[model samples]
Target: VRTYKLDTVLLILKCTQESKGCSWYIRAAKIAGSDFFSVTRYRSKHTCSRAVQSSSNCRRRGNPRLVAAVLHEDYPGQFDTPVPKTIVDVVHRRAGVTVSYSTALRGKQLHVSDVRGTPEEGYRMLFSYLYMLEQENPGTKTNVQLDADNRFEYLFVALGASIEGFQ
Candidate 1:
């Protein structure tokens, strides 16, 4: 709800209970000539209590992709660092969003899948990738061995540049 439209200069957000007179709001303004937005004024305290989230009203459920993106920033080089408990705690502390164990697991899974696709999908795209590799390098060589069931068994790649430089 854009109670106040976010513009290049100003961004303001009001509490869901604004109509009920809950005085929780934040207003940030862009610093002139720089790309920084500073919190100009804020009433961080939510005077109105939020209604208990019911099963039907699960809008607060953390988005897996958003959780994954935040996790990436927190553990950039090491995606596998945080475990279940750590994941739950970290998201709550950093994102101010409470998530269940399953949501955390799903977020990690989503992040990993985005970075390194499923083995099946990788194998499916392997030939096309190698084709482009060959086209780019001009003298690249690739050998992919398939088993009786046509499953991937072996892969060998020798770039044309490497071959020429060796001689």
Candidate 2:
């Protein structure tokens, strides 16, 4: 098993009337290690299994890269996973509120996610959420401090570009 420094970030999601959506998150360190181990495991396990069959025919017929299919079971719509452009409403609603990052930053740590989307959109969305959070929390001042130097520099660099450039 591998270990990493703890981190957290804030997430906000719009709720459906019936049920609030949930979030699943992973850290960057684990993501890197998992990528490495997954490739190794896929090669070894698939090769071992394939050994039981006619290797020559199997090699010709199969796309061996299928072994690298991660999150095939949990991610909805593998073959049909709805792309963001196609499912704007679902994407908007599914991204319910997340609080891991802001809290982690308070403790001077980092957080990560593998969510696919434009960084500009994420920044806009997060800012909107922060405004709302401030509104909801009324009395207290809502201030955000970047704990990591890299993150602070990244935010500055990103903001320097035209907002649309991120999209």
Candidate 3:
């Protein structure tokens, strides 16, 4: 099992079996205000062995780049509707590597950001596009609703009978 401390951001791992003299343990601490972590203490190099067989196909879980590429390349149109199981199946089929749902989710998030840009940038582009549409076609009705924070809540656009079929 693994345990984490909130104050120092230290992680401790120990064998689940309740033995007083178990040498299998690891302790790691996060560098303060940094994205780095260091293993302060480690033992049981030989005392602990794999209790269950590890799959060779599980290597892709560590490769976010590969997972992102798979998500973007294989299911471009299904980005908003992608299921984690579908991603797992595709990665296994193409690269013969298995990944967890969380890994697939992270990869999907990366792919979405890569394709759609950040939310702030997207909102900026949206406003610009709306302005451009109003400029190109005069008398176009464009309405935007925002919350108390001035963030986007809703947007409505009417082309003002330019199409001639619908009023």
Candidate 4:
């Protein structure tokens, strides 16, 4: 198993058992001035193999939170055109776990959908904003652009104000 220390930014590896005199462990420290970690010390051999179980129940695929965090950190601006393969690679590199294409795609979909609500909800919010503006200021002009599917495309609001002495 592996553990992370956010305060020190160090990764620690140790035997599954916590008994004393167990010399199987490794400590990795982050190198300064670079995004790399070096193993400070390692025992290489293990004597607690008998105590370890044969079967494992831990997940091999990256979890949803981990996938989402990696994608958000790696692709902050590429949400509109997210590449699933690229996300998969990022997750593997950052978390030391390989995720399938479908997992990556689902993670991106969840993140994007959360940020950009459904088409109906988006339109409702847009219309409410337009209504608020019109009610607050009389004679305000608002224009909305819709796509072929009746989804919101663009918004233009004129506050009935002159720009550079021109209306």
Name the best candidate (by lDDT): 1
RMSD values for the candidates in order, in angstroms, are 8.3, 21.3, 8.9, 10.2
lDDT tens string, model 4, 24-92? 778888899876679898888877666565246465578666687676676664556358888788788
Tens digits of per-residue lDDT, candidate 1, 82-162, equal 776788888888887788888888888887776777888988899999999999998899999999998778999999999
Clash count, candidate 2: 16
Q: Candidate 3 versus the native: TM-score?
A: 0.48
Every model's TM-score: 0.49, 0.23, 0.48, 0.46
Q: What overall lDDT goes with each candidate model? A: 0.79, 0.31, 0.71, 0.73
1 or 4: which has the higher lDDT?
1
Worst 10 residues of 1 by lDDT: 52-61
Q: Across residues 1-167, which tens digit of lDDT does each residue of candidate 2 receive?
A: 11223333322222121122212222332234343221111111121222243323322111212211222333423333433232323322343212232232221211112234457778658657666755665442344556666253322222323444555
Model 4's alpha-carbon lDDT is: 0.73
Clashes of each: 0, 16, 0, 0
The residue pairs that clash in candidate 1, if any, are: none
Between which residue pairs do clashes occur in model 3? Answer: none
